[model samples]
Target: MDQSFLLMLSNLLHLHNHLDPTSALLSDAHSPTSTSSSSTSSSLLTSSSDAQWRSSYGLSYPVFTTVVDKLKPYIAQSNLSLPSDYAVAMVLSRLTHGLSSKTLASRYSLEPYLISKITNMVTRLLATKLYPEFIKIPVSRRRLHETTQAFEELTSLPNMCGAIDSSPVKLHRLPSDYNPSTYRSRYGYPAVQLQVVADHKKIFWDVCVKGPGGIDDAAHLRDSLLYNRLTSGDVVWDKVINVRGHHVRPFIVGDWCYPLLSFLLTPFTWDRTGSPAQNEFDAALMKGRTVVEEAIGLLKGRWKILQDLNVGLNHAPQTIVACCVLHNLCQIAREPEPELWKEPEESGPPPRVVESEKSLYYIGDNLRHALADDLYQRLSR
Candidate 1:
């Protein structure tokens, strides 16, 4: 293992001592019980009670087992000394509780190095092996219909398929080669950026982590593969509705920090400077945008590791992506929501239109105006 990785592990182990005493005590008390209960189960997989499993892993026992079953072949191929289920559970525990390798090693009676290896391997599998199955755009007719219908109910925005946002994942320590300034987020922390698009159910359909914390949200978004696909017309949503003669297609809602595009719509004016109809449209669009914000909160809240991401720089993206995958799994399973992780308030000027996208921008502008007028007229009656 790299010395920087070990150093980060050491720093995290030390920081773990400063967490809430009550939570630490509760975790310590129940962790052994969770272990013993799993040993008695037929597959030696999960805690006896759903509550116990959720407390330990932020998911129900059935979902935990489902994850294990899904990853079993991949984990088995790794030839891990521990059973595939046990390895998955162990890694989930670390991700859930933000436990350090030393702490986890002590709990499971394994060497710290082995614990680190298991964490990396399992997270890699979750991020890559399971990502395609869990996180994907709603392209199918049924899925798209369901998603758009749900959002229409929430925001009264026709053909709205998802909401988009980005959050900074703070790093516990910077890498040796990194310039501190380059890693510093607007929140004044060294971090990485995680951008996601989520449906009205708070389930993620798209996840991207391609830049350092210093990168602006709009810039990071433009650099994403999703942006390329959308710009190139490679990704298509067939559902379209005519509002005031504008053929409104399936689209996502975002805040002013992201550029306004034909498929990605932002508010008309962030400060209510627009006309009454425009203001109403902005309110409705914002209501839709809250889904992505809530999704990010649930992600960080359930996967506590994201609160203070301690992984090495190279592994940070995979760690964040794995948490997104797990978030989708939990959402699909209808797991109880945790306390929301409140982010710092966002404030910034709207993004400038991309030079090459001016035509699309004009189209989106006309579409927004038409929708606003149509929505205003409908509400007036």
Candidate 2:
């Protein structure tokens, strides 16, 4: 009944007010709520053709089949033999094409409650079961070396491991009782931030889904396990890679929104104010950091539901993380990028304030200057 939910419903129907697109779907979806607890469980098929397969769920027949096969073990039950496949298809109905639960219930001839249940079940599976195997940061020395080589090739900077960035996924404004202020975003709605780390290939290696879309990137990253391990020196990097006599640490490149550290390198400045050498380093760093941006682009592009999370706030983090897991899966499956995918305008970063860690801050500044001068000298030749 709230304005935000109404907005979501209006957007979902997208029908002229005169047209009652919901009458049939809603009546059918809510039928099970009646005294009769029985409803026919028929297959979902509109007169729409194979094109609907891709358009409705962002999966071709073959890919859908493969997903079914992969998820069968976790979702199979005697009450629902191919439950996993149906569950996956149900979740994708919203993720790929942004169909509401009522609309999907009508399409599948199932109840709205059942549709919600299936979607939640499948999302948890992807987030918990599949995430471990697919969404891992390359820790092995050989794997780290490969990722470093890839980043170095892209930016002409050595020992680069990954690009980091955060994107806000829009969500329905929470109920009045739910403290909506926590979810407020720059986009004039509630949202949750999806922080990601990606390689040159635009595959996400790490995802942190802890932000309420209001927190700054620096705070979010600091709270992440990635930061804890990196600072604690728990993650092992290969022997110091000497780049033209400069000791390069295995580091990830971020934008000016993040703080620079021995292991996490951000640009010296956003504007071109520094010396040519420092400017050159910033240019290369920004160029390489685009990988995470592009990765997020591809992610939200493929899963349109993330464009507006439409799901409950309790499920927002799980849903975003699940989408990342599925993104990696699709990339692994060699699925082609979705055509006509448009990247959403990301929220601007807040002005950074150095709270503490002055000693390390100075060290980071020295490292940036050194790298910039080194790169500038090379470019001069």
Candidate 3:
């Protein structure tokens, strides 16, 4: 176990001692009555209405139960005193409401240590056990067609499969041995960088947490598994369309912060000084990019823990990835969305081209010009 994690637990325990547990427990509107025990926790799991369940657990009762059922076997193996449903609910409550373990301990009438233990267990399961099932690339032909069609309708850009972007997940506290400078984000906070590829409906298909927040988006992306897979020709999207005599394969769009490649496209210029066709293509690409931005917003909005990620450094990546899995689940289940969490305006110089990728970059450049001309002609018609 990390010393910082142990220190964090000690601090929470000390904070718990100063807190009025009874009053704190009662203050939570979603908390069960004062006499409530594990039985009450179980009852609440089965009884809460959809709205109430969403308020307390960030998803409707049905979705909550779906999650509980899926993880029940693994969670039951933990040998917790509470029922599987209750334990999952308690952890979701913490994730949904951004409540500390001490606060959750008061609400659930359990030791703070128990709360932390359960949180780690459940989040780890979600990030690892359930991740591959929930978050996946649209490899199936039908799913791929649906995604590309939706993106085409949304942005009028042909063969756009997904939009990629990166955001900083802020860390509330840094480990003692870590230098703050390496983790300091452009937003002036210690954080880890999370890169994701969101489809038309803002469902994340790829997620990577590889570097500190201070790492620029381009560098972080270069370190990702998705980058390798795409560059190495391992992830081949079968759908291809010819635009102005150029064979345009399914590609993802990003802002200027990312490099342009045959499989990944970025804006030609941020200043809009190019030809009318180039400007139109840039606008359309940005429209497609909005889906990923909204996806990140919805992620943080629903899982409040992401807004000020309080988990330890070692566990931060898993926690963020867990929230992403939950986000995809909720999106798939068609749960009601909360207000979006807006990020500050982003500004950065264009990324430098990679020497090894120059050949691929030339191909991408030709494709962009051809696609722009094609799109401009069609729109004119």
Candidate 3 lDDT by residue in tens digits, 1-381: 344433433333333223222212212223233223334335334544677667777888788878888888898777654456656766787799888776656753557887788889999999999999999988889999999999999888889999999999999899989999999999999999999999988999999999999999999999999999988988878888888889998999999999998988998899898899999999999999999999999999999999988777998999999999999999999999899999998889988898988998999999999889888999999
lDDT of 3 at 380: 94
Better of 2 and 3 by lDDT: 3
Query: Which lDDT values do the candidates have, in the order given?
Result: 0.83, 0.70, 0.83
TM-scores, one per candidate: 0.88, 0.81, 0.88
Candidate 1: residue 54 lDDT (0-100): 80
lDDT of 2 by residue, 60-140 (tens): 656666666667777765243223443575577678866667775665455677657767778877888878888887788
| Best-to-worst lDDT order | 3, 1, 2
Candidate 2 stretches with Cα past 4 Å from truth are: 1-53, 60-63, 77-82, 106-108, 244-246, 339-356
Candidate 1 lDDT score relative to the true structure: 0.83
Candidate 1 colliding pairs? none
